[model samples]
Target: MLNGGMKWMFLILGTMIGAGYASGRELWQFFGHESVLAIALFTVMFSICCYVIMKISYETQSSHYLPILERLVGKKLTGLYDLLIILYLFTTTIVMFAGGGATMEVLHFPYWIGIGVLAILVVVLFFWDINGMLSMNAIILPLLIILLLAVLLLFIKSNVNAMLFDWMKQSNWPAAFTFTALNILPLVAVLSAVGHQIKHKGEILIASIGSGVILGGLSFLYNQSLIQVAHDLLVYEIPLFAILKSYPYYMVLIMSFLLWTAIYTTAVSGVFGLTARFRDMVNLPLWIIALIIVTVMIPFTTFGFSTLVAFLYPLYGVLNLYILASILIFPVLKRYDLLS
Candidate 1:
């Protein structure tokens, strides 16, 4: 049970700590100075949301996000939200592909070659179906988490004098809601597909709480490190490189690898959600569905990494607020329904 829970936790982390988050762009976008309170609020809200979504998924034994979406927002709105989720998964996965291409370009690889490689890898990943993704996350996320935290901790240690604690000026607290909302769709899409695999409620608890704590901690540390390099942010497309500036060249190369892996994991999660949603309809192998999806998404990667993230992320964040609210209120409503 412990191992199972950890697997799900890693899956959630893999889905989240993608190109944007790992590159420090997403954290800086939603959180920065005066965000200590915001990060804490995000931690609680994120855990509650994850627990509610996983509970619904497990109960329904969902094969895709549609069932869980219906439970969260009722049948009438499920179709609309389903489209929204499909779009979210599609666009974000493109961002990941673009991010992969950009990362490789930094290492002197051709951009198209990088995108093609990532696309091929994503399709190949689904050959084993869901287990491929779960297994990959289980192996990759731990190392990514450790390296990211290590870099952030080292940065914090060196820059302790620059750290500020101004809890009284936490106007950015509202960002907690939007940022958490931004992630609800993918969480639903991915977690719902694994419902039948979930053996017990204990796994959900571990996944929800564990992912929340790890992500929350990473957000705090990453945001702090980004804050120290706020001025240098404009000079680099990837803000994480700004943080890595003082480090050795080898560290930059290592982090570039980390960033690419993060991109691959999220891209895999996105493809998983999309392919799972269409598995029954297409009547084809999962890899074929993923192949077709990636084929369609490749051209969009030309939009570039940061551009796609900047334009789409905040837009989805705002649009997903209703879903976020519904998930947060689900437990209360479930109890009320039982009483009635």
Candidate 2:
């Protein structure tokens, strides 16, 4: 049986790797070669954020998510909190959908077919049993690790340039790294959900954060590899796959599955979160709500994937800062309140 700490670690690893590392897009922009520092910063921040979220969730255990929000921000701010979280989840869902489409295109599948199939499947899986759905991360995370390592091995064997030191000096390094943290905010939301489930709060929080440290360190190394081959990376739709293409088509299959799984997990999680939010208002059942949400959002897939990344991602950064600050300052405020 998995310990609660292990389960929490699995959740964080599954969530982090889904977008931050596996997508290849994040490391491409965030750290590139210079991403080493960004990754280090992220790991430390990630651990701290995990601790804060765990503390908050533990303190408010058995309450639904909204009441906790009301307590943290006060009733006067509840409307603002709902609006902000809704926007955040909505934007995240769009990214995941767009990313899923892009991943399909990268894997040589028809754009609509790939996106549509995954959307429907995710709806089913999420609604089939909401509580049981957490297990999806545990099941898929190991495969993502295996596939990531295989790609790394192939890149190494091909003698791909491993130095991206030149990219460390690029002007966008700071902006990119900043955006990477912004990009990962949805991850914190999901981690909080998992934290809500855990019985051993402190141990799970520490172990989950330890996983982030290990992952962020490894991601820094991988981002550098892309910088080493910057020219080739810029041209390919799926640059990581291009790197591993030197091996065999079979390798592409493995890589494609890994990439798609990453995007798919993020998409599935976001949509489920969104659907779960509206369960009380709708006259229909939970599955029906999930179905309607995914179906309605599916058409947005026709729009450009890169376009959403370019537009919504920066806006997301602004909102993320507030959430990050709130999480960070909550503890200090709590301490001060107690003293008073």
Candidate 3:
């Protein structure tokens, strides 16, 4: 049961720590100075949201996000939110693809080659179906998290004098909502598909609390590191590179590989959500569906990595607030039998 919970927790982390996030761009975009309270709020809210979503998914044994969406927004609004989720997945996956390309470009690989390599890998990943993605996350995410946290901690320790301890000026607390809302769609999309696989409610508790704590800790550390390099942010497209400037070239290269893996995992998750939703309708193999989706998304990567993230992330963050609200209120409503 503990292992199963950890597996789901890794899946959630894989879905989240994508290019924008692993690269430090997403964290900086939504959180920065005066965000101490915001990060705390996000940690609590994120855990609650995860628990609610997992509970609904487990109860319904959902095969896709639609049933979960229907329950959260009701049947009347499900269709609308369905379209929203589809679009959100489509665009965000494109951002991951672009991120893959961008990460490789840092290693002197051609941009298209990086995107093509990632797309091929994503398609091949589905040949093992859901198990492939889950296994990959289980292996990769722990290493990624360790290296990321190590770097963030090292930077914070080295630059302790630059660190701000202002806890009261938390005007950016509202960003907690937007950031959590930004992540809700993918969480629903991925977790709902695994509902039937969930054997115990304890797994949900473990995953929700575990993933929330890990992500929250990483966000705070990464945000602190970025704060010191705030002025250098404009010089680099990936803000992580700004933080990495003080490190060795080999460290940057290593992080570049990890960043690509991060992009790859999220891309796989996005394709998983999308292909699972359409597989029954198309009556095709999951890998084939993944192939078609990646093929279609490749052209959209031309929009550039940072550009796509900068534009779409905040927009979806705002639009997804409704779904986030519903998830937050779900347990209360369900407890009172208000959902009926």
For all the candidates, what are their Cα RMSDs to the real structure?
A: 1.2, 3.2, 0.8
Q: Give the per-residue lDDT digits (tens) of candidate 2, residues 1-340.
A: 1466666666666556654357566567555644555566667666666676666666666223465555456677667867766677676676677677777786668777777877777777855654545678778876787668656755755654564345355544355335544644555455445445667765656664677676765676577667656778666655676566566778777777787788777776676556656765677876777777777777775666655665666666655666566665677888888412
By TM-score, how accurate is candidate 1?
Answer: 0.98
TM-score of 3: 0.99
Q: State the TM-score for model 2.
A: 0.86
TM-score of each predicted structure versus truth: 0.98, 0.86, 0.99
Residue-level lDDT tens digits of model 1 in 149-235: 998889999999446778789989999999999999999999999998999999999999999999998898889889899999987
Off by over 4 Å in 2: 19-21, 62-64, 71-78, 153-185, 192-196, 338-340
Regions of candidate 3 where Cα sits further than 4 Å from its true position: none
Among the numbered candidates, top lDDT falls to 3
For candidate 1, give the lDDT of residue 281: 94
lDDT of 3 by residue, 1-340 (tens): 8999999999999999999899999998999888988998999999999999898899998889998998999999999998988898999999999999899888999999999999999999999999999999999999999999888888898998546768768889999999999999999999999999999999999999999999998898889889899999998989999999979999999899889999999999999999989988997889989999988989999999999999999999999999999999988898899995
